[model samples]
Target: MSALRVNNLAISLDGFATGDGQSLEAPFGHAGERLHEWYVSTRFFHAQDGLPGGTLGVDNAFAEQHEQGFGAEIMGAGKFGPPNWQDDPDWKGWWGPNPPFHTPVFVVTHRPRPSIEMDGGTTYHFVDAAPSEVLEQARQAADGADVRLGGGPTVVREFLTAGLVDYMHVAQVPILLGRGVRLWDGLESLEDAFDIEVVSSPSGVTHLTFVAKPR
Candidate 1:
């Protein structure tokens, strides 16, 4: 079966997925970059960014595992770019020439826009439908491969609350953001609905995996 997974999703010690005031300059917000310090220092991330010879450890291993999975991806409007920028004709994406995603990416947006083809076989498909509709389209495009939930908390929260996600891997960072975009804010009964398994690495990053119980 094809699983819908969120891999290497970082969350603060206080359960915030992203910090406040997300913009082009501050993608993750104030202290949000601290959550991803482990990833940035990994060899896997370096290789993806066209660098070489990074630290080989638990962090690198986890990063490599995340980079390998997911044939297709689904991101929210905010995850792609600013909502207002969608109306502009010149704005393409935050990534200038080459994007990190090498597979087909379907972006959920209210506004309509033409498909954008980027380098490395990555094409962004703008979907004007609901989250379920976008997931259905993504499943079809994935073709037996897993669908990755790429997001800015809101998108992932929707999928989780809807009980559409098959598996989720969240990397709980050691830092505390205090206040920001939370990952489990909207879900009222998530703990009761799904079974969560916890795993810890040497780098103090905790991985939480959630799987829905059979109904």
Candidate 2:
């Protein structure tokens, strides 16, 4: 069976995963690049940006894992676009023509639309189904590989709430967003289900891995 995983999700010291007022103009919102400073300087990140070089450290090691095994992606409507994006017929998504996800992408949204096949191997299929339903579709699309739970906090929370997540890696940044979307909302005692290991990097961000224990 393919494992469901959340990779490289950054959170604030206060536990906010993403700031408020998400839009095309401010994808990371008021939090800006504060949460992603760690990975942004990694060689893995520079490679994604089509740059020549960047730091090769513990951060880079973790960053590389995000792209290693996943065969398909599942993300929230918020991660797809800003508010009212569904109304824009011309919106192709935040990643432009060639998205980083070079695989089938199942977008979780209330308003379904026709599938979009991007320049890369990415194909966006919008669905209004629950986590389990979408996972079923993505599992078939993954073709025996792992499934990535790409998120914008709200969506991650939903899947975590549904107990569908098998593994997760969260980078706890130093900054604190006083108010914003939180990943752990209503998920009390969630650690009870997983075995967590913490590793701090020289970049000042702490990496946390949550591996789901046998049920």
Candidate 3:
């Protein structure tokens, strides 16, 4: 069946999904880019952005799997672009012309904007609806395929806390940001059940996949 999956979400050693003070200069927060070192060095990311070349190994394999696993993607306002709201309606996104995600993308934002058409099949839909409502719309857009939760911490936390996420893949990096946006911030309790089905890639990056068991 269709599942709400979070694939290749990076987290720091300190459990921070994003560093503090997110802006255009620091997209993933101050030191958040460090968490995604594994991804940026992979051939999957290079090929996605039409780069020349990159390494091919376990990192590449994981990157490829993560990229291909999702039919549609959901991002929070913070992940899509700058945190501050703008009055202008023409701001497309951080991606200038083409974005990496060539599939339907639903962005959860308080401000409403018309759907953006990119060079590839990628289209960004700004939804002012609640998280559950947006997820339903994303499911429809996914066409029976898995929906990926791509985010800026808050979104993932929401889905997790709501018990909507079926599976999650976290790439734990070795670095630590003392103060930043944490991944497990809003979780009500540590007793919540999540079964770790797979854990591997201990060398370059630590990959862990967990399946949320029904309570």
Model number with the top TM-score? 2
Q: Mind giving the per-residue lDDT tens digits that candidate 3 earns over 25-130?
A: 8887788568887888888888876897877877677778776657789998888887774555667888878887788999898887889889777899999987
lDDT of candidates 1 onward, in order: 0.83, 0.91, 0.81
Q: What are the RMSD figures for all models against the true structure? A: 1.8, 1.0, 2.1
Which ranking of candidates, highest lDDT first?
A: 2, 1, 3
Pick by TM-score: 1 or 2, better one: 2
Across 71-182, the per-residue lDDT of candidate 1 in tens digits comes to 8999888878754777787777788767888888998888868898999878889998877888889989888888989886889998887778887778899888988889
lDDT for model 3 comes to 0.81
C-alpha TM-scores of all predictions: 0.91, 0.97, 0.89
User: Which residue pairs of candidate 1 clash?
Assistant: none
Best by lDDT: 2
Lowest lDDT 10-residue stretch of candidate 2: 20-29
RMSD of 3: 2.1
Badly placed stretches (over 4 Å) of model 3 are 50-53, 188-191, 197-204
